[model samples]
Target: MDPYAWSWNPEGLVVLLLAAGYVAALRRYPTPWWRPACFGVAMVLLLAVSVSPLHMLAMQYLLTVHLFQNVVLAEWAPLLVVLGLPPALAAAIARPSAMRLLTHPALALPVWLANYMIWHLPWVYDTALEHPSSLLHLEHALYFLTGLALWWSVVQDAPHELRAGTRAAVVFGAFVLVSPIGLVMALIPRAIYGFYVDAPKRLWGLSALQDQQLAGVLMALEQAVVFFAILAFWFARFFAEEDRREEIDRSPEAA
Candidate 1:
């Protein structure tokens, strides 16, 4: 594949079709407009980074682009998917005690962290790149799945799920745990991924070390954006819930 030009991925076509099918199902059993809207945005983001020319750039040219792509898939897309999940579907998920436990911080956090670290290891990273024909799609799928699990504990609205306070702690602690990987990547002066060392630069004037640093900054900045947004939401929600309870407490005595 030409690193600079548009390319048709069979997988991309399959994904687009599947996304369309999902949307059609949502229409048949529609929730609110916002649910489909969130889902549509997720699909667009998935296609933008995974199927578009951006994927080519990441695969062939820059580690920065690769990390950015992963961030979009892992962090951004899955969150939207969570928001878009139908109430009916969520209700079904509420039944299984074991499955519910999977979303707890203890389980979900470690699974996400382990899968993420495993993929980033030097040899694992290189091997995935080396077998782009096979392993690359699996790599992206793993990131997206782990991401879904990571956010599940924190984002669920079901009564069976973690309380808002616990969810907030889980998400914040995850940021503290995961941010260092990006920091190390951004602060390093030398190239960390040997795969890109001799690769030809396609668009940017960046050298390999610069590309790695850019990837790191992307990792750090994106995590900051997503984590802080969620935290702000939790803060407001926690205060609002507390105020509501106090208001009820202060209501006039009833017969």
Candidate 2:
């Protein structure tokens, strides 16, 4: 049995089912034509990195490939999936009691942070790479669950105001926290993982050092793009609201 066969079979099936379910759920809402289109594009990009031929080809160069996979799974994929507002589907899944337990403030916050910390540990990361079939599953599950929790806090279909400033702060704070991990990976002179150092290079004229540097660059760039994009969105919203407020205040109705 091919160890990575699960990626093609089970993973692909899950992605398809999720996509179908998302479409079904959106039928009740008058979602604009473009919203599902955007979600589809994001899903394509994500799965291309994970389950497609690109992933298979890249895996020949373990370091670069694994880094690509990690960024897609942790950053790009999660952000896109969250933007899809799948929590509406989630809201459908749970009864009142289950929903209360799942979204409870005390349980949710700690689980959110703990999930983030657990996945980033060097030991856990290396172990996943070595045992991709077993440990990798755990790593992916943690990534997905933590991502759901984080996005739920911001984007869930709930009667809550996620202040623009606060959301920007959260995005940047996450970027800052994850940045040190990239720095550590870049600073290390030797290969941290034996699997990568042992695997044959598939890409053009790139040594292990080059591969590692590329990975670090990918990590830094991905974080900057995501964080700053969210920050700018919030800032724009803030200014727009301020302008509207000023316009309202200038009216003579108050006098």
Which candidate leads in TM-score?
A: 1
TM-score of 1: 0.89
Clash pairs, candidate 1, are none
As for model 2, its CA RMSD to the true structure in angstroms is: 3.9
lDDT tens digits, residue span 1-255, model 1: 578676566557755985877776676566888987887898888888867788888888888888988887778888888788787766566568876776667888888888778888767887888788789878888888778777777787653455567777878888888898899988977887888886765458888888888888889988998898898888777788889888888786541
lDDT at residue 113 of model 1 (Cα atoms): 82
| lDDT per residue (tens digit) for residues 1-255 in model 2 | 232332462555666777887787787754656667756865786677657765554444546566666666666666666566544554654336655554443454556556656665756666666676677766766666666555555545442345666555656666676776666667778666555566654355666776776777776776688768877887787788878889898886766
lDDT for predicted candidate 2 compared with the true structure: 0.63
Cα lDDT for residue 31, model 2? 60
- Give candidate 2 misplaced runs (Cα > 4 Å): 1-7, 57-60, 86-117, 156-159, 200-203, 243-254
In model 1, which range of ten residues has the least summed lDDT? 156-165
